[model samples]
Target chain A: MKRRNLLATAAMGLLLASGGAFAQGMDKVKACFVYVGPIGDGGWTFQHHQGALAVQEAYGDKVEIQWQENVPEGADAERVLTQMALGGCNIIFTTSFGYMDATNAIAAKFPDVKFEHATGYKREHPNVSTYNARFYEGRAVQGHIAGKMTKTNKIGYIASFPIPEVIMGINSYYLHAKKANPNVELSIVWAFTWFDPAKEADAAKALIDQGVDVIASHTDSTAPLAEAAKTNGAVIGFGQASDMAIPEYMPTPRVSSIIDNWAPYYVKRVGELMDGTYAQVDSWAGIKEGEVEIGMITDAVPEEVKAEAEAMRDAIAAGTYHPFTGPINKQDGSPWLAEGATAPDGDLLGMNFYVEGIVGDIPQ
Target chain B: MDFGGINPVILIATLMASAVPILLAALGETVVERAGVLNLGVEGMMVIGALGGFIVAVQTGSPVLGFIGGALAGAVLSLIFAALTQVFLANQVATGLALTLFGLGVSSLGGQGYNGIKPPPTEQLLPDALADLPVVGPIFFGHDWVVYFSIAMTAVLWWVLKATRVGLIIRAVGESHEAAHALGYKVNRIRLMCIAFGGAMAGMGGAYVSLARVPQWVDGITAGAGWIALAIVVFASWRPWRVLIGAYLFGGITVLQLNLQVAGSVIPVEYLSMAPYLITILVLVIMSAGRKANGAPAALGQNFHASR
Candidate 1:
């Protein structure tokens, strides 16, 4: 009788343990993604969706993902976010600068929900966090490639908005290009749109017509590459995003890409929440983290040129290099830094002026 | 610009393809104006059709279904314009403006999911060799069937307006609704049908933008082509042949500018980029200032109610 009683107790304990495991497995965390552009824009937001896909894959059984694309930066965004919160979204990401206010307004109303905004500065409340990438670092890589490859000493840059982010990239690209080819000149073309293939193509062609032998674009599209392909033997271009992964479109797109790896951040936060260590945080990662990557340099790049670019990339990865180092000047020919005096993070983050090697006004 | 390195055949082909959107929209508007309803909401209608067709096509993976869905979506949205102007008798201008704002919001809401992905491949009508011929091929046989349909539509519209008895009735209603009512014609009914047809065409144009041209969906995809089409109606003096010329001219400028950039023009990128829109505006101004400026249908933009 005693042995039988002990066996029954063991069986009951096993049943309870199994039930607890099942309950844990069924517990759900709701997550939502709001995008500024369509998922097929083949650029910024598309890559973010890819990161979200990674999160979905990793947390297959534990989380639910909902996404809204082409969300404008106004009251409609606020309404959609409210719907997300009401729908039981425990974590939400609003991706765009215009979404900053809406995110904060919604965050204040839903204290239980955690909010994250991409490429935005405002981080209010205990639940709000801001995140962005060091795209300028990748721009430095592009600058290096354009500088070494251009035979005309003229490089064209197709830009979107003249915002700090874009300006920082232009300055970074020109600084590095000028370092390698002292005589290199950058002609600027602003398309003023995030994703218009027609506009992007037009801007790229404008640059090509002006005798620019190499092209780089801050706008999202392979239109610039399409423009480059039309140019003569010396013309080359880089991919803004990996959307131009076609083999023939390489070399200029040589450096891989600065991928926005939001998966690690998302998963890490979720893990922290499970462990009772979650906290609101704002973060930025550059070459140190794996967010920025170097794509394969094709046979088009000369051996010595590849070696020099690789050395610079290595130094950047090892924290020994800075793209905007000493002896730089603003477009007005005023010395921005005394010889050998590097620019500070504060200045670089707020950069609005063209560097010495760049020509053309930041068209109003 | 460097068309020297680029194939002339390829350049011309791209230009004709670009003309498809404008051609579709303008042809639709020509019918609308023929019935004496001046809709400034073509842009709005086109965008909604773009979003609707794109969403359906992406969901069903059928371009035909996308086009049909787009036409229905457009017709429904136009019914709102019809109801306001027909039933409520609201100011046509204000109602059209409100319709645009409403369509933009609705499409933005409906089009959230299908962004950024490449569209499913569509079937082509012509073979490569025929498509690759020089001037004759591109201007005639190289286009998608829609291009041919648009051309055929222009001829059909011209015949319908000039030769058909139904055309006489529509023109009669447009010119003097009270007189047409005395003659036993339902002016409102005819105008309503014309408005719906206009909406469908605009929607089809929007679908073309999503399905054939860009072959992808995005927010604000139509941009401002609708507004341009509305303007072109007046610029073309409301003639079918003129509408075709205006569309190709607008389309050609856009294509030519891009080609110049590709061929390597020395112009500033900003200025060259604005070339298409600037040229369109210039043409409109020049045309409008001419002695025949008053060639628009006399009853255009005027709502008629024949209570007598």
Candidate 2:
């Protein structure tokens, strides 16, 4: 027993030495990912898996990539994260807003295992990091197009959750739509899930029945476009998380899309680990960093509207204009930003209110 | 025409469409339970049906044929459960759960390369002229054939179960299989046939989601509708007409909740969000405590083995 104790101590010392070495230069890096939806979802999870695949292509044999899909964000995530950490995942990326707490909790347990959480702002431990794409930037583009094209002036948003990330998208989309057309009315139905195709379809159908001609969804699925297809040119919608440019609904219901581009950030972080320059970082990149892209504006949009939307996109990409630029007000008519004043990062990160002129309370 | 921004006609129309899937699934379960079997694999069978229906619809370019293919797929999958619980004398509950896991595995494996593909549009049965008539037209007409078929099935199921000789044999086998065996009735054989009917119905219900409602293939597309169907069976006390009422009640509240939110009603979204589950639980509890629950098959969930 005494010899076993001594041997265990010696093994612990060796592990610590290797962990220290791992903190520095490493010959090989194993990057793992946990996704909230199936990779075949053709939307959010599909795109994140694409980013994981990009890491493999970028580093080849130097990096080993592993991923688990359809991981629900809660205790299940903690279990999966702990397993991956014990399995020697050098850096684990939890790719969903709901995983904020689990990522931080698991990060604390495994101080040597680096953690990167997407679209969340909880970095309780030094080993945990947070990164997110400014998806609202893409929403701004879709809103402008939705506002310009809707004949009914009634638009709808199928919200996944009441989280700040989704709330921010709602406000941005509605703000831009309200700016383009003062008469536009935005209807929101919280489906309360990230990727249930059947529920998403019901929400979209509800909106269509209520005469909403322009639709946008915060959830991950193409069923919204499929439901929009049933309208046969009456209603139109934009693809969320992926360029749903499928031949079935393209140029019609899927007039445009917001593609989440995580490859650059993913490849960059994996490369940083390889070069011994890794540090806990908070990244919030948008169109400028190529993290958020507006998919092609189909010919269905009027030429002038398409051109104007493209101009806004370029301005956003060039850092000359902010999507949440001034003259904005809280839902109750309280002033949020003065004219010529853009929203600060702090306010957008924890946004919880609907902008003015968009009626209805945000579900708490 | 509107109550709290919800057009009653349109709300009812959407409710009918939404309820059809669960209605069909629950209706099938009603038959299975009456025949003295409880297969909890409705979810498994439904998802496989979704995949089968979507693939066939996309391949053959015929939505009608797609539903048939879905039924065939679900029936084939349920046969595994039927064989296990009936012939092999496995525990119905455990095998049903395993069947769900197996179906999920088979679907994800089979669903490769079918993502993002849309099935052909399901044709609405009625003429547009009839469908365009105000209130009544939108509320009662213009749905795909499944809606009418489900309602027809409900009525037919009620008639057959309450008044027919075949229904008597199934119930006899369910109430006392030993007595059924003494009467020279093939107990396991009758249960097998009933399980197949349940599977075929569940498959069609699942096909409705992929072929008409969502009209696209996604892994696990049924998403617990089968479990809800099981719950509805308990809620309805295994009766056909009550299953319809239970399905529509759940469906109505589901559609109304979203419409209420869209209308920006004074009701809280959080409360509305929980309303469906609350009502379902409330009904299930009330029915189980009531006298109607005496309708349960005496020999439900039991395996039959031949004896001297």
Please count the clashing residue pairs in each candidate, in the order shown.
16, 0
Across the candidates, what are chain A's individual TM-scores?
0.85, 0.96
lDDT of 1 by residue, A118-182 (tens): 77777788889987777788788878888988888988887877677789889998988988899
What residue pairs are clashing in model 2?
none
Return the DockQ of model 1: 0.13
Off by over 4 Å in 1: A1-27, A109-112, A124-126, A227-235, A247-258, A339-341, B1-20, B36-308
Against the true structure, whose DockQ is highest?
2
- What are the TM-scores, per candidate, against the unseen true structure? 0.69, 0.95
TM-score of chain B of each: 0.90, 0.97
Cα lDDT of all candidates, in order? 0.73, 0.89
Poorly placed runs, candidate 2 (over 4 Å)? A1-23, B292-295
For model 1, what is the error of residue A92's alpha carbon versus the real structure, in angstroms, after optimal superposition? 2.4
